[model samples]
Target: MTPFTSRIYLLRHGEIVEQDVLAGGTDLLLSDVGFSQLSQACKYLTDVELVQSSTLKRCSEFATQFSHNHQIPLLLTDDIREFNFGDWDGRKYDELWELTHSPSIGDFWQSPWLVTPPCGENMADFYQRVFLWWQRLLMNIVNNHTHKQLVITHAGVIKQLLGIICELPKESNQQNMFAVGYGKFVCVEIYIDNMGKAWPKIVF
Candidate 1:
């Protein structure tokens, strides 16, 4: 068995406009505070190698800055877009709470995996896309044999990645695993064992 080391760093993009709402799939740019957060995050990753971000503007903006300063190419992929909120996009939690007929939203509040938003994607679908994306990313890391790979994406994307890497149950909680404030960052170190399995060893 051969031990291959591939370190992947997952980062949730900074805050966006209307964050208090359930703005899933809404392609809004980062807020002013988000810019500050992105700047702070760049400082922490000054030594990172490859950089990538979701196609969405919020993530892409920060990725551009990081790549520019570090002189590393920034790649964009659609695999990391935020969860599609469907009809719920651009609406706030309070608005959803006001809907009297739909108990489904309440169910989603309790267990996000159980309730599929009306006209939106189910948890399984979301997980599958994320998993596929991660597999591709892992393949790239293995091919390049990079020591550090930085990714800027959404909170939902980060949560799914954590679940996969940590081997957490699919039904695990989804509360703020990386609710990284605008410009703040969470560092996760993924290690590849001798069997070619990648797992998160350290997260900060």
Candidate 2:
């Protein structure tokens, strides 16, 4: 029996106006350069059969346009939005780094699972939410027999999903290895055997 194959493109949205800020909750739209980046990154995405996106404007705007242009079905969801930064939601990174807080931005990056930002979503809870969302997503994909799907989301979400697929430690600090720049897409290929088991690999 032939194994079933699925390809999912985890695309990070393009740059925003305040490129240096943690504006996940601010919902800032992408800049012109950012739109260009997103478009160019998706130039070769003709094979995608479906498109999913974070409800945030930065990702959804482009996802809508891509879906319309490519004639693919589009879905907007909140489960895959960026990690809530709370008080740091709309602040610049440099500003946050200069804070006198105990667990500063640097501290969080070094040990995200252990450090919860000021009034922000707990890293553990965030991880669990994304993980659950991912599980449901894969099941849906397999059940629907989808060949290819595109997901437009944030850097943190993509990194978390990648870590899940690789079974990496939460302290792995995937930013160093992934370095998913704005408008970049991490290609993942999933293989399901006839025995009803699934294996996922990061193709890029």
lDDT top scorer: 2
lDDT of 2 by residue, 30-145 (tens): 99999999999999777888999999999999999999988999999988999998888999888888998687888887887788888899888878888998898888867777
With candidate 2 superimposed using the best TM-score fit, by how many Å does residue 198's alpha carbon deviate from the native? 1.6
Q: Compose the digit string of candidate 1's lDDT tens values, residues 138-172.
A: 77665666678788888888777777767777776
Worst 10 residues of 1 by lDDT: 174-183
The TM-score measured for candidate 1 stands at: 0.87
Alpha-carbon TM-score of each model against the true structure: 0.87, 0.93
RMSD versus native structure for model 2: 1.7
Local lDDT at 54 for model 2: 94
lDDT, each prediction: 0.76, 0.87
Candidate 1, residue 3: CA error in Å?
3.9
